[model samples]
Target chain A: MDLVLIQLLNGVQYGLLIFLAASGLTLVFGIMGVINLSHGSFYMLGAYGALTLTQFTGDIFLSLALGVPLAFVFGFIIEWLFIRHLYDRDHLQQVLLTFALILIFNEAQKILWGSYPHSVPVPGYLQGGIKISQFLSYPYYRVAVAAFCVALALAMMFVIQKTRIGRIIRAGESNREMVEALGIDSRLLFRFVFASGAALAATAGIVAAPLESVYPGIGEPVLIISFVVVVIGGIGSIKGAFVGAILIGVADALGKVYFPAFSSSVVYALMAAVLIARPGGLFGRAA
Target chain B: MHNKSRITRRDALKMAGVGAAAAAFPFARPAISQGAPLRVGLLLPYSGTFAALGDGITNAMDLYVKQQGGKLAGRTIEWVKVDDESAPPKATELTSKLVQGEKVDVLIGTVHSGVAMAMAKIAREAGIPTLIPNAGANVLTRAQCAKNIFRTSFGNSQPGVATGIAMIKAGIKTAVTYSWGYAAGEESVAGFKESFVAGGGKIIKELTLPFPNVEFQAGLAEIASLKPQAVYSFYAGGGALKYMQDYAAAGLKSSIQLWGPGFLTDGVEKAAGAAGEGVKTALHYVESLDNAENKKFRADYNAAFKRFPDVYAVQGWDTTQLLDVGLKAVGGDIKKQDDLYKAMRAAKFNSPRGPFRLSAAQNPIHNFYLRELKGGENVYLGVAAADVSDPTTGCNLA
Candidate 1:
C-alpha cells in the first residue's frame, strides 16, 4: 500500500512535469498551426544554460533565474531569426525545418558543452527524502517539482483568463487573420508566442535536469511525449495539455509497477484510447 | 613539403580508407586471403554514443602493435579501424566492408552486444576469427554463438553469478533481480539464478526494467513492494547513476543492498559523485587488482589520458593484450583460420583480472570479483572465482 502511494506520487510528479513541457508545444501548434519539432531542443538548451550557470555560480536558484530569462531570450532570437518565417509554411515544412533544428541544437550543445551528460544537483536543502508516513517517503526534489509545476499551471490559467496579454493571445489564436487586421503586429506577436513557448520548454528542462540529468538527446523522448500530450489534450489548449499529461503519467506509472513488460505500450495505449474517444483531443478543435 | 614520410601515396590511401569507412558504404569486398600486410580490423564505434570506450579500445590496440616491435610477426600489422556507430544495421554493412573490401584477416572490438552479435554472424560466414573485447550478451556465445567468434573479456554471466554467489555466501535468502529487460539482463539474471540456487539462495522477485528508458524512482517503489532482502540490477550508461541516486533517495539503500554488473564505474558514473558510492557490483576487472600488469596499465593510461581508466578504457586495453597473446603466437597468420583458432584457444595471457580460459563455446571462462566504488575507484572486495570458469555456454562448435 505504501509502495502504491509512493508510485502514485511519482505519477503525479511526472504528470506535472509533462504538463509543463506539453502546454507550450500544444499552444504553439494549436494556435499558430505550426508543428515545432525543435521545441524539445529549446528545452535541452535551457538545461545546458542552467547547468553552465550553476557551474559558474554554484547556486541552483541563481542558475535557474539566469536560465529562465536566457531561455526566453534565446527562444525569441530563434523565432525571429528562423521560426517567424516558418509560420505560414506547411506543417510538413515546419517539421522538416524543426527536425533540422534538433540536429543543430544537438551539435551546438556538443560544441559548447561536449557530449557528456552533465549532472545537476538539487539544492543541498532539498536533496534528502521527506518521510510522508512510517513506511513511505518521497524525495523533496520530486515534491518541489510537483509543487512548482502546479504553481505554474495556476499562473498559466490566470494569464489566459485574467490578463490583457492573455486576451491578445487568445484573440490571435482564434483568428490570426482578424487579429492582424486590428493593427496588432501578428509577426511580432508570433515571435513573442514562439519565444514564450520556447521559454516554457527550457524551464521544464532546467527543473527536471536534477532527475533526468542533462544530455545531448535528452529532449527527443520528452518531445515525443509532449506531442502525445498535445494530441490527447486538444492542440493549443493549456487545459488539454494538463489533462493529457496527467493521463499519460498515470498510465506510465501504473504500467511500470504492474505490466512491467508492456509498460512502454501503456503510454501509447492511452494515447490511442484518447484518440478513439475524443477524435480531436479533449481541448483540441477541428481545422 | 614533399617529404616521403610526411606526404605520400600511403598516407592518401590511409586517409581515403578512413574517410570511406566513415561515410560512403558499398566498399565491401570478398574473402581475399591473398598474402597482404596481415590486415587486422578493429571495428569500434569511434564517433557514436559508445565513442568513450571505442576510442580507448582503438588506442589499446595501437599500444599492442607498438609492443609487438611495431609489427605483427614479419609483417607490419596494418590496422583497419572502422566505426560501427553502435547500430546493428550500420555494423552489418560495415562488417561486410571490413571483411570484403578491407580484406581484414581478423576482426575485433565492439561495445554493444547487439552489434557484436550481428558482426559475429558476418565474420563467421566469411571464415574470419572474431574476438570480442567487451560486449556481454550471452547469446553471442550461446544460442547464436558463431564458430569463428571468440571472447576474451568476461560475459554477462560473471556479474550475475558472482553477485548471486556473494549473496548466498553473505547469508541472504530472498533476493530480487532488477535488470534491464533484454538479452544482457536476462543472461546476468539467469547466471545469477543458476549460481544462487546452487548455493541454496532463493529469489522472490525478478523485475525487468527497460534499458535507457526507465524511471528509477518508479522502479524503486516497485522494488520496495517486493520487500526482497537484496536487489541486483544490471544497468549501464547514464542509467547507472540515476539508479544509484534514486535507490539511495527511495531509502532502499538502508534496507536492501544494491548490486549489479560492473558498469557502476563507467565514465558516466564518475559524474554521479557520491551517489554511486557504496553500490556493490560484480566486475571482471578492477583498478584495485594487485598486479604488475594493471599497475603499468594504470600508470600509462593516467599519464596518457590524464584520468583514471574506467571499465570501458580498461576493457579496451586488456582486449588488446588478450589479442596480442594469441595473434603473435600464431605469427598473425589469420588466413589460416583453423591454425589461428587453434593457437588462440590454447592461448593464455597475463592481465590485471588474472588468467582466463576460452571455453569451447568461443567465450572466455573468466574470473569475477565483488567490487564497490570508493572515492571514484573500483575496490575489489573478494574474488568470486579462484580460477573461475563457466559451464553453461550453449555454443555449437560443430
Candidate 2:
C-alpha cells in the first residue's frame, strides 16, 4: 500500500511537471494551428537560464524570478520574428524549421555552457522529506512541486474558463475564421498564447531542474512526453492535457516500478490504446 | 639587372618544379615503407551527449603523443578524426568511411558499446590494428574478440565482478540489483550476480528502468519496501547525478548501503555533491589511485585541461601506451599485422591505474579497486581484485 501510494504521488508529481510543459504546447497547437516543435527548446532554455541565473545569484527564487520572464521575452521575440510567419505554413515546413531550431538551440547552449551537465541547488528550506505515515514519507521538493502545479493548473483553468481573454482563446480554438470575423484579432492572441506557453514550459523547467538536473537536450524527453500528453488530452484543451498528463505520469511511474521489461514501451502502448479507441486522443476532438 | 630583365628557361623550369612539388605534396605517396607518420583514425563522438567524453579521450591521446615527442613506435603520428555521434545505427557507415575512405593504418574508437562492436567487426575483417579506448561491452572480448583488436579499457564485467566480491567481503547478506535496462547495465549486473552468488550472497530482487530515464521514485519505493541489506546500481554521467541525488533524497542513504560500478560516481561525482559521500564503487581506475604514474597523469592533465582527469582520460592515456608497445615491437610496421598482435598481447607496462597487461582475449587484466566517495571525490579504498583476468570463453585467437 505504501509503495502504491508513494509511487502514486511520484506519478502525480511527474504529471504536473509534464502538464506545465504540455499545456503551452496544446494551446499553441489548438489555436494557432502551428505545430511548434521548438516548444521543448523553451523548456530547455528555461532550465539553462535558471541554472545560469542561480549560479550567479545563488538563490532558487531569484534564479526562477529572472529566468521565467527571460524565457517569456525570448518566446515573444521568437513568436514575433519567426513563429508568426510559420502560422500559415504546412506542418512539414514547421517540423523541418523547428527541428532545425532544436539543433540551433542545442549548439548555442553548447557554446554558452559547454556540453557538461549542470545541477541547480534546492533551497535549504524545501530540501527534505515530509513524513506522511509510519511506512511512507515523500520528498518535500516533490510534494511542493506537485502542489504548485496543482495551483497553477487551477489558475490556468480559471483564466481560460472565466476571463475575456479566455473567451477569445476558446473562440480562436473552435474557429479562427469566425473569431477573426467577430473582430477578435487572433494575431495578438496567438502571440500571447505562444509566449505564455513558452513561459509555462520554462516554469516547468525551473521546477524540474532540481529533480532532473540541467543539461543540453534535457528538454527533448520532456518535450516528447508533453506531446504525448497534449495528444492524449486532446490538443489545445487544458482540461484534457491535465487529465492526459497525470495519466501518463502515473502510468510511466508504475510501469517503471512494476514492469521492468516493458517499461520503455508502456507509454507508447497507452498512446496506441487511446488512438485505436478514439483515433484522436482521450479528450482530443476528431481530426 | 640586365640578367633579371631576360626570361631564363632554367629559372622558369626551377620555379615550375618547386610549384609542382608543393602542389603534389599532400597527395604524395612512398613514406609508408619508410618511418613516416602513421595515419591513426579516431572514431569518437565530437558532437552530442558523449562529446565531452570523446574530447577527453582525444586530449589524453594527444598528450601521450606529445610526451613521446610527436612519435609513437618510432613513427611520427598523423591523426584522422571522425565523430561517431554515439549513434549505433550509423557506426558501420562511420567506420567504413574511416577504414576505406581515409585509409587509416590504425583505427581507434569510441565510447558507446554498440558502436564499438560495429567498429570491432570492421577492424577484424580488415585486419587493421584497432584500439578501443573506452567502451566496455563483454562481447567485444568474449564472443567477438578479434586477433587484430585490443581493448586497453576494462570490460563491463570486470568492475561488476569486483563489486560483487567487495559486497560479499563487506558481509552484505542480502542485496537487490537495480540498474538501467541496457547492455552495459545488464552485463554489469550479470557480472555482479555471478560473483555475488558465488560468494554465498542472496539477491532479493533485480530492478531496471529504460536507458537515460531519471524518474526513479517507483523503483526507490520498491527498494524501501523490500529493505534489502544493500543495493547495487549501475548508471553513468547525468543519469548518475540524478540517481545519487534521488537515492539520498529518498532517505535510503542512511538505511540501505548503495554500491555500484565506479562510473556511478566517476565524472559526475562533483555534481552529485554531498549525496555521493560514502558510496562505494568498484572500478579499474580512480582519480586518487596512489602511484607515480597517476600523480604525473593527474598533474599533467590538470595543467592541460584545467581540471582533474577522469576515468575516460585515464583509459585513453593507457590506449596510446598499449599501441606504442605493439608499434615499437614491430618497428613501426603496422602492416606486420601478426607481429603487431603478438607484441600487443605480450606487452606489459605500469599504467596510471597500476600494473597493466592484456588477458588472452586482448582485454586488460589488471587490479580493480574498491573506492569510496569522500569530500566529493573518489578515494581509493582498497584492491577488490588483483590481476583479475577476463573469462575469455568464446575467444579463440589461437
Candidate 3:
C-alpha cells in the first residue's frame, strides 16, 4: 500500500515536470498557431544556460534568475528572426524550419559545451527526503519541484482564463482574424506568447537539471514525451497538458512497477488507447 | 685466392637474391622500405553521444603514433577517420566504405558493441586486420571469432564474472540484478550469474528496463520491497549517473549494497559525486591503479591532453601498442598477413593496466581489478581475477 502511495506521488511529480515542458509547446501551438519543433531545444538551452550561469553566480536561484530571462530574450529574438516569417506559412514549412532549428541548436550546444554529460548540483536545503512511512521516503527536492510546477501551472491557468491577455489568447486561438480585427496586434501577442512559452520550457529545464543529467540530446527525450502529453491532453489546452501529463506519468510509473518488461512501451500504449477512445484528446477540442 | 673470394661473394649474392625473390614473391611486397604511408582507417564516433570517448581514444592513438616518431614499424601512419557516429544501422555501410573505398591497410574502432559486431563481420569477410579497442560483445571473441580480428578490451563477461566471484566470496548470498535490456546488459548479468550461482549465491530476481530509459524509481521501489542484500546493474554514460544518484536518493544506499560493471562508476564519478560513494565495481582498468606503466601513462596523457586518461584512453593507447608489436615482428610488411597475424597472436607485454597477452582467440588475457568508490574516485581494492581470458566458448579459430 505504501509502495502504491509513494509511486503515485512519484508519478504526479514526474507528470508535473513534463507538464512544465509541454505547456509551452501547447501554448505556442494554440495561441500562435505555429508548430515549434524546437520547443524542446528551449528546455535544453535552459539547462545549459543554468549550468553556465550557476558556475559564474555560485547560486541556483541566481542562475535561474538570469537563465530564464536570457531564454526569454533568446526566444524573442528567434521569433523576430526566423519564426516570425513562418507564422503565415503552412505546417510543412513550419515543421521543416523548426526541425532545422533543432539541428542548429543541437550542433551549437555541442560546439559550446562539448559532448560530455554535466550535472547541476542540488542546493543544500533541498538535499534530504521526506519520510512518508516507516519504510518509504521520497526526495524532498522532487516534491518541491512538483509543488512549484503545480503552482506555476495554476498561475498560468489563472492568466489564461481570467486576464485580458487571457481573453485575447482565447480569442486568438478560436479565430486569429477576429482577434486581430478587435484592434489587438496579434503579431505582437504571438511574439509574447512564443517567448513566454520558451521561458516556461526554460524554467522546467532549470528545475530539472539537478534531477536529470544535463547533456547533449537531453531535450530530445523530453521533447518526445511532451509531444505525447500534448497530443493526449488536446494540443492547446493547459488543463489537458496537466491532466495528460499526470495520467501519463502515473501510468508510466505504475507500468514500470507492475510490468517491468513492457514499461518502455506503456506511455505510447496509453497514447494509443486515449487516441482510440477520445479521437481527439481528453481535454482537446474536437477539430 | 682473390678470384676464389670473388666467386664466393658472387655465389653469396646469388643466394641472397634467390632468398629475397622467394620471400618477396609470395608476400606480395618487395621490402619494408620507406614506401607510401600506411593507411590506418579509424572507424570511431566523432559526433553524437560517444564523441567525448571517441575524442579521448583518438587522442591516445595519436599519442602512441607520435611517441613512435610519427610512424609505426618504420612506416609513417596516415589516419583516415570516418565517424562511426555510434549508430548501429550505419555500422556495416560505414565499415564497407572504409575497407572497399579507402582501402586502408588496417582498421581500428569502436565504442558501441552493436557497431563493433557489424564492423567485425565485414572486416572478417574482407580479411582486413582490425583491432577493437573498446567494444566488449563477447561474441566477437567467442562465436564470431576471426583469425584477423583482435580485441584489446575485456569481454563484457570478464568483469561481470570477476564481480560475481568477489560478491559470493564476500557472502552476498541473495542479490537482484538490474540492467538495461540490451545485449551488453544481458551478457553482463549472464556472466555474473555463471560465477555467482556456482559459488552458492542466490539471485532473487532479475529486472531489466528498456534501453536508453533513465526512469528507475519503480525498479528501485520493487528492490526495496524485495530487500535483496545486494544489487548488480549494467548501465553506462548519462544513465549510469542518474542510476547512481537515484540509488542513493532512494535511500537504499545504506541498506542494499550496490555493485556494477566499472562503467557504472568509472567515467561519471565526478558528476555523480557523493551519491556514488561506497559503490563497488569490477573492471580491467582503474584510474588510480598503482604501477609504473600507469604512472607514466597518466603523466604523459595528462601532458598531452590536459586531462586524466580514462579506461577508453587506455584501451586506445594499448591498441597502438598491439599494432606496434605486429608491425615490428614483420618488419612493417603488413601484406605478409600470416606473419603479421602470428606476431599479433604472439605478443605478451606489460600495458598501462598491467601485463596482458592475447589469448588463442585473440582476446586480451588481463587482470580484473575489484574497485570501490572512495572519496569520489575508484580506489583499487584488490585483483579480483588474475590473467583472466575469455573461454571463447563457440569459437573455432582452427
Among these predictions, the greatest DockQ belongs to 1
- Model 2 misplacement above 4 A: A132-136, A181-185, B1-37, B46-49, B74-78
Runs in model 1 lying further than 4 Å from the true structure: A111-118, A133-136, B1-59, B62-106, B325-334
**Candidate 1: global Cα-lDDT?**
0.76
lDDT digits (tens) for residues B1-398 of candidate 3: 23323433553475476467647776654355446578899999766556667766777888889888989988988777888877899999999999999889999999888899999999999999999988889999998999999999888888799999889877899999999887788888999999999999999999988877788877887788888899999987778888888888878888899998898986677888899999999899988788899999999988866668888889999999999999998888788889999989999888889998988889999998899998878999889878888887889973
CAPRI accuracy category, model 2? acceptable
Error in Å for residue A144 of model 2? 0.9
Error of 2 at A2 (Å): 2.3
Clashes of each: 4, 2, 0
- The CA lDDT at B367 in model 3 is 90
- Output the better candidate (2/3) by TM-score: 2
Q: Give the TM-score of candidate 1.
A: 0.88
> What is the C-alpha DockQ of each candidate?
0.33, 0.29, 0.21
Cα shift from native, residue B35, model 2 (Å): 6.6
Error of 2 at B308 (Å): 0.4
What is the C-alpha lDDT profile of model 1 across B224-269, one tens digit per residue? Answer: 7777878888877556666777777777777778777787556665
Superior by DockQ: candidate 1 or candidate 2: 1
Q: Which residue runs does candidate 3 get wrong by more than 4 Å? A: A133-136, B1-34, B46-49, B101-103
lDDT of 1 at A231: 87
